[model samples]
Target: MANKNAPFHPIIYVRGYAMTPGEIDETTADPFCGFNLGSTVYRAVPEKERQPRKFIFESPVIRLASDFGYQDVYEEGYDILDPEWEADPDNKVPSRAIIIFRYYDEASRLLGIGQTPNISQFADKLRLLILRVRELVCKNPANGIGEDDFRCHLVAHSMGGLVCRALLQNPAAEFRAAVKHVDKLFTYATPHNGIEMVGVNIPKWLDMNDMKNFNRDYMAEYLNIKDAFKATGRVDWLPEDSFPSERVFCMVGSNRMDYEAALGMSRTFAGHGSDGLVRIENAALHGWRRSGKNKGSAGDSCAKAFAYRAHSGFLGIVNSEEAFQNLTRFLFGDIRVDLWVDVEQIRLPKPVQDEVLAGRKVSALYQFEILASPRGKLWYLTRRTAEEDSVACLSHEEWMQAPAQRQALYLSSVFLANRARVNPRRRSLAYSMTLGVRVPDYEVDRRLWVNEHYEGGYLFRDSIILEMVPPKAEGDAWQVKYAWQGSGVSKADTAIDAKLLGDSRMEVCVPFGSSGSPGMQGQLRFIVSLWNKEAAGN
Candidate 1:
């Protein structure tokens, strides 16, 4: 009776941190916290420059209900988990639903005593909640769901992510069954490594209001990773064996200027390269790859994206179109594509070339900017730019001295669901990528080269657009087409086939600029394949 093939399991939303008793009561005041809150955003189209378009994004709750037919478990002013809760005997709640993990209720003045629990205790209660949800969905004769058929996904924001991580990575025997029932995890702007203030990690001794939950040493104890303060001295990773890293997704926020807490004191101390509170570098896990042997490698790399939204506010990451679109696709997507850059060589600038020819020691720094968007959509899937301090950096010496092989960088991953596309009639899946390699800042003999310096200049830049139609069935070839924004090629030109890797995988290589010259040059390799093909065969 399981609907595993449908891939629409229950989504448990765990909200982010609330620092005070007042904030605790605020979360308790609302039935679904802020999950039910909708946001209205304005868009200015380039074609109609002056006319701003109003895009009303109904909250995730509303969209899920209207688009996916998911219903909540609340009835007659009481949740299914409430002590006095009662509902129609034959009308059971559907398997597709959203459950709010009210971990803060026990600490709320209106709901319970005003004392917050530690992260471990919160995770423990989550285990119990998962069990209770199964009882509600599986025992009912109306839905035909069995105990074996029930599975749930965890969706958390900020510190809430840490609470879930504590459960998933918990090594204790008691939590194993609950961990098994959780199929996937998605987090938004979570400080996975622990929060840093004034360029230092938050001390465990700062134990006010259980703020020590954000401390790295304390987090290591709960996450059950020993010596997590690795050579990098950061615990921004989970043990590979704890959870299937591929099932996890992280959404990193880059805009800190919009956070207005404490009259902007939060953003000031949290500083740049942060989402007003959690730094971008600490937002994602170390090991989060969907495929490959990560047994002894550095932590796995989860599928993640970057957004310009701040930590929490009207412009926060949780309630935005970009976040929602990503959430829907990842939860029920058909195809998965990962983009990586293999730098064959980086040609130096005219001036830098002259210095290198003179056999002088020249040093430089290269930064890469990546932004991706789905076709016919105003919002992007991921955003990383120098302006947001979220771009990738490479040292000239490392690329030169390191192995000549081309496995240097990864941009991001984007998923596609024909079911979630703009036009149902159109069969092609398309997205555009804006990738740029900045001009290196030359340091001749470790000294700054200010003479020929210009700000915001790039050695190479282009928008790569890809349009593809999935294989009609398994073992069939894929029809892929691509065009470059500045290359004078159009989508109407022709379609290129992806290079088929054995086992139903495909790859498309898009090369840019000239190689081994006095300009930047490299290849963007796209690995494409069926995602959860068992669930959605299309």
Candidate 2:
């Protein structure tokens, strides 16, 4: 039986964009099921080993758009392919992609199918499809019915991620709400940012043709292309504006095999740091912020919930274990938080220390969010298995103990070494460093929950306190004090004097070792103030 206070919930896995026949095949192709659903690669083998396999080919239900008919070289000059140019050589070639959904039973067996054409019409058709799926599942009797009726998980690949993102961010409140009913989303090789399809510059004449035929005003009526284009912005996979990252789990491939292809492109749009097509930065919610530190709001609470993983290639990303782990974890974790910590101290380059005299001031602390249960038990979520009673608790020291973990800790450093290497201000010696926020809790919370309420309310009323020990120089001791200025304040600050951190870290707590409350509702402020041994100013 689940603990009375546990809050465990079932998970729904949502996968991302899968290119349709139009998007991938020069001619019309079938909706290609990603490697996770099992590849359609017809493996040659011995005649004795031959056996029947589940095949998903083109669905007769959907028709190909005439404009999408195949052609040789693209005529469009615009960086992005516009649908109107598919027919004319003078026009830019359209990016052919597909949309298909396959429902699965609880046992993970394919149940039914739904397919749609890659129309220029914004998500208008996709919105209707979401509603139709809801209605169909609820009404049909042969469709294995259950109390958890809304069991569909949207699995998209490539451009399909963009389609799903549009669905999730639909202005139509009904459509947005309907899509929320879907359990989860899984995406593979989705260029959340615009994909670089062999970067073709259209002739100046094609630009004029777009103004005449595929003009924003003209396509706005039936296709809503203007808004869709606006939402996708430079990034075709995600909307131009921010999205709720929490609900979605993005899988990004970091392989940069097409380095030569991406060399001529602008730094911002270059896919050299991406999976042959989409950049890793774009695969995540664009306006991602650290959970606790206020960086202004992206306006969508649900959107804040998402997890991302890095793998090698476009096709390999979907078929790899990393993708599967990220997908399943996002659908199942119990504690979710977007955490980011800045290492201002690391900015010191050794020689410059005497110039400033005192150690560099920490403009921002190494911050990470804590998504433990109401009962202050992080162990509930971290435990390895059901039979295990304890889970490994990670402090800043343990977290960055390994090289891989340390590298992850210094994200800003990582980005700087890669595509973000250009120095903006050489004359000015000072440099600004920022690290990408890690939805650290998302992997642990959504994926590791024993039930909906992490460990099924095992902790009851206790609140968690998270502390990190930094790697500081020996004998250069410092004291750490914590304070919170939220709706409720603790009676006294918790002070740690010991060398809790081997280097330069101090212990910090959430809810700050305070007494339990009737229920977990109010937000508590947590501050870790550092003081010198001489009791000088912090």
Candidate-wise lDDT, in order? 0.81, 0.32
TM-score of each: 0.93, 0.40
Name the runs in model 2 displaced over 4 angstroms.
1-32, 36-99, 102-122, 140-151, 196-244, 258-271, 287-315, 335-339, 342-344, 355-538
State the number of backbone clashes in model 1.
Answer: 7
Report the number of the highest-TM-score candidate.
Answer: 1
Task: Score residue 504 of candidate 1 by CA lDDT.
Answer: 67
Enumerate residue pairs that collide in model 1.
Answer: 287-299, 287-300, 287-301, 288-300, 288-301, 288-302, 289-301
Instruction: Put down candidate 1 lDDT per residue, 1-538, tens digits, no spaces.
Output: 5454357888899998998889999999888888787667532221223543467888889998999888887777778776667445544557788899999999999989888888999999999989888888777665576777678889999999999999998877778878888888999999998998877888999988788888888887887764556444667776666788778889998888777888999889999999899999999987632235643347547888988877887767887888888888888888888888878777776777788889888887778899899877888888888878888877788788863666468778898888867889988888889898885468887888877577887777888889888878777788888888887865624577589987668998877775444466678899897877656641
Q: Which stretch of 10 consecutive residues in model 1 shows the poorest summed lDDT?
A: 42-51
lDDT of 2 by residue, 58-136 (tens): 2111111222231222234321123453344333211121224422111121221323333223255555555544443
